[model samples]
Target: MQALLQEAASRLHAIEDRLTVRTQIAAAVAAMSIALVSTLAAGAAIISYRHTAALIESSVAGIASSTSARLDRFMATRRQEMKLFTELEPMQRLWQGDPTELRSALEALQRNFDFTWIGFADLNGNVVASTGGLLQGKSVAARPWFKQGLENVVVGDVHEALLLASLLTQRANNEPYRFVDIALPVRDTSGKVIGVLGGHLDWTWASNLIADVQANDGNTDTRLSILSKGGMVLVGPKRETIRYGGDELADMLKVRDGTFRETVDGQQMLTAFHVGNGYRDYQGLNWIVTAS
Candidate 1:
């Protein structure tokens, strides 16, 4: 009877050991499964985050590209028009010594275009013909437009009007008039350079153009800016200087056209930029257009 009882006890101990081993194996498999699921979830989250970031960058870049193209077209069209103006009948009458006809033509241009003033200066830099005859009989010999227009077609940078602004009605806010200069040499039928044709475009046209662009896009959150080659802010939400040398923004400028993430003037933003690729024969001004 004692031997039978000992054998039963040994069998029961063996059964208990097998059950413990199986339980541990089952627990190990469950832990491994949970770990694998967690890793997959983490990987998926990372991929989603990267994709969202890429999409935002691409969208901003697209807006910048579109704005650049529009500006190029605007500039190219104006340049082409200036070229055509040289061939107008009234302009051709210059060789006939008829400054009145040329003045009429320029006046007609002002009616159709946003010209603050347009004039044809003689070789002596005396304004012989002008829009509305405002500056006619005046000597602009010392003006940069008169000097540069003698050689070639020149697109001057924006500047405060010196004498032209005072000749006009004052703005309600008494703001100073700003102008962009465009000039080219005028030649007679003999191909001999006779004089220089120059025009001052009101800066308001540009501001209006940008406003229309932003309104059409319907994206109020996105801000666009135009910068000179040296990074001076030419047009934007606010006229503020952006330091260009030795910063990450400088590195991005070297790329000429791309997207970047950076903090500008204490605001962190994702920005897209496209450098001016001047339209056909226009030889762009190398302005940097940015959308953020």
Candidate 2:
């Protein structure tokens, strides 16, 4: 009887010892698991921080690029404005055999502006003085630009002008290269209107201007041109060749009053239009400037 009782106690003690060992093993595993989880979480946080920092740096770089581009445009515009005031102003004042003024204006308009030709037209649409080749002594009586100027009854303000055969100077190959005319009205000191002061605009220079303006901008395809309401090509004349007498032209006519943007032929175009009215010296002309 004593031996049986001792055997039963010994078995109970062994069972208790086995349970304590199992509990200790579970606790150790749980502690190790917590440490592993903590280490993984710290690694994830560090990675997230690095990603955020990289994004911030990229954003800052974009902003800096935008700022630099804007500054460049501002500088270019300022330079052009200065040239207009300092160089063009004096030339504009000279008239009637003031060869120096005419020469100065001509040089500035052609060489500096990259225009192919320069000329003056009377209120009656007579050619006064022409500088450069192939246009001297040419009669412009039948030209659309002259007729439009007569019809509109205003001059002097800059607007787009058109060209007709014999009105424009012939190119070196004798092929007529049409150009947009940037014309204003000429006036006497008494503000009496005399004629239209006009010159040719180089499309290449104009393209450069557009590229400069768009160096940092997106979402806008622009055109700078001169045209009649009837879809005549003046400046950037090639545009008319591609889109003659279509719904595209109809869309353009809708926004001739101010600077605006529209989609034509599945492309975005920003445009600014102005009709010529001579408040200074030029009077009585209907001309338009379109910048898209």
Candidate 3:
């Protein structure tokens, strides 16, 4: 019995030592595991951040490219219509000093095209005829389109159409009407400039184009902008951070087309841009389209 009791006591001591050794081993293993987990978590976070950035850059680039292509197509169609109008027999007759015929031609153009105003101007910048009779005889000599028409087919900058707004018999809104003038020089058979033919495109059409692009995007946080060559904001969200002709546009002027990171309104943004390369057979106004 004494021998058995001594043997039992020895076994207990051995078991206790094993348990103590296991506790030490467990504590060491737990400490190592915590350190390993912490290191792995940090590495994962870095990878995730980089992946998200790459994704955003690629996505924005795709959107910008696609939107630019659509805009080019839209502008191409308008340019074709403009060219066709200039080649019409009635337009030639108007150039030959037929005011009544010119008015009829202008009326037909207004019915067929989406222009806010279609008009013909003499070399002296006097309105020979216009779709809206109110603008007849108005002097457009100081207008940008008139000056540009003397050189080449050009699209003018966006501006509030004060005169047109005043003449509107029915207005949908009190906000001033905005328009972009597209003009082409009318030349005779000898290639000498005879007159200027132009039309005003509603700025709302451009705004709607941008809005449609944004609506089709899955990202709710994304924003889009259309900027002039001089870095003026032509189209942007109705936010203070993005305003017409705002300074935020300065960052876009340096690059012709590419993806970049910029801080706008104190928030970091990834932006992609494409420069306008006029539609087929027409010189495109160098506009920048961006998606962020």
Ranking by lDDT: 1, 3, 2
Give the better candidate number (1 or 3) by lDDT. Answer: 1
Per-residue lDDT of 1-292 in model 3, one digit per residue for the tens?
9999999999999999999999999999999999999999999999999998888888888888777777767777776787678876555656757777787787887788778898888899988888867578998888888888878877776788966787865556666678878888887767788888888888878889988989889865668888777666778854223332445455445455788777778998787888777677756677788888
Higher-scoring candidate on lDDT, 1 or 2: 1
- Name the weakest run of 10 consecutive residues (lDDT summed) in model 3: 239-248
Compute the lDDT for candidate 2.
Answer: 0.51
Order of quality (TM-score): 1, 3, 2
lDDT of 1: 0.81
lDDT (C-alpha, whole model) for all candidates: 0.81, 0.51, 0.78
Which pairs clash in the backbone of model 3?
278-284
lDDT tens per residue, model 1, 1-292: 9999999999999999999999999999999999999999999999999999888888888888888888778777777787788876655765347777778878887788767899989899999989878889999989998899999988887788997876988999997888878888888877888888898888777678777777876554777888777777778855647645456557656677998677878989998888878888787777788888
**What TM-score against the true fold does each predicted structure earn?**
0.87, 0.40, 0.76
Candidate 2 RMSD to the correct structure: 11.0
What's the distance in Å from true for residue 157, model 1?
Answer: 1.3
In every candidate, how many clashes are there? 0, 15, 1
Strongest candidate by TM-score: 1
RMSD of each: 2.7, 11.0, 4.0
